[model samples]
Target: MNDYLKNGLFLAAGVAIGALGAVALGKGKFSIRPAMADLLSHGMDLKEKTATVLERAKENLDDLMAEAKHAKESREGKSVAEGETA
Candidate 1:
């Protein structure tokens, strides 16, 4: 009888601890509502910042390509002049 009682008490404590853990980890509805809201807000802000950075990168890439083309044309002209003199 005493052994049975001890077993019952241990089982009950285990169940209570498990319940508390589940609640703390947001397993139940309404448990993690505030955390979810914060995550969504931060995600939105991150997306906006990422888009802005992408736009700036695109503009910089275009400028670099134009500069490269200009440099290539100048080099070609110099080569042609050298060939004519030789």
Candidate 2:
């Protein structure tokens, strides 16, 4: 009924068809195992890279949040310092 729903269903069907086609083609001339194995062998590298990226993101976020908190406190502290009770 909805345009978004219809479009989503169409996109899903297209992805399903493409996946089926890849599997069918793999059965003949393409070997999915070796490729997947190569990727799997790099699993550690992927994991380490992902962890490093996440750690850096978390550290940056923490630093930013701390700075934001300090700024907020400074703004609020000004009012208290000026003899205003809020």
TM-score of each: 0.57, 0.54
Each prediction's RMSD to truth: 15.7, 5.4
Off by over 4 Å in 1: 1-26
Q: How many backbone clashes does candidate 2 have?
A: 0
The C-alpha stretches of model 2 lying farther than 4 A from their native spots are 1-36, 84-86
Over 13-84, each residue of candidate 1 has an lDDT whose tens digit, in order, gives 999987986877765645677876898899999999999999999999999999999999999999999999
Put down candidate 2 lDDT per residue, 2-58, tens digits, no spaces.
999999999999999889968877687766677667978799789999999999999
Candidate 2 TM-score, C-alpha based:
0.54
Evaluated against the true structure, the overall lDDT of model 2 is 0.89
lDDT of 1 at 15: 100
* Count of clashing residue pairs in every prediction: 0, 0
Candidate 1 clashing pairs, residues 3+ apart or interchain: none
Native-vs-model 1 lDDT? Answer: 0.92
* Best prediction by TM-score: 1
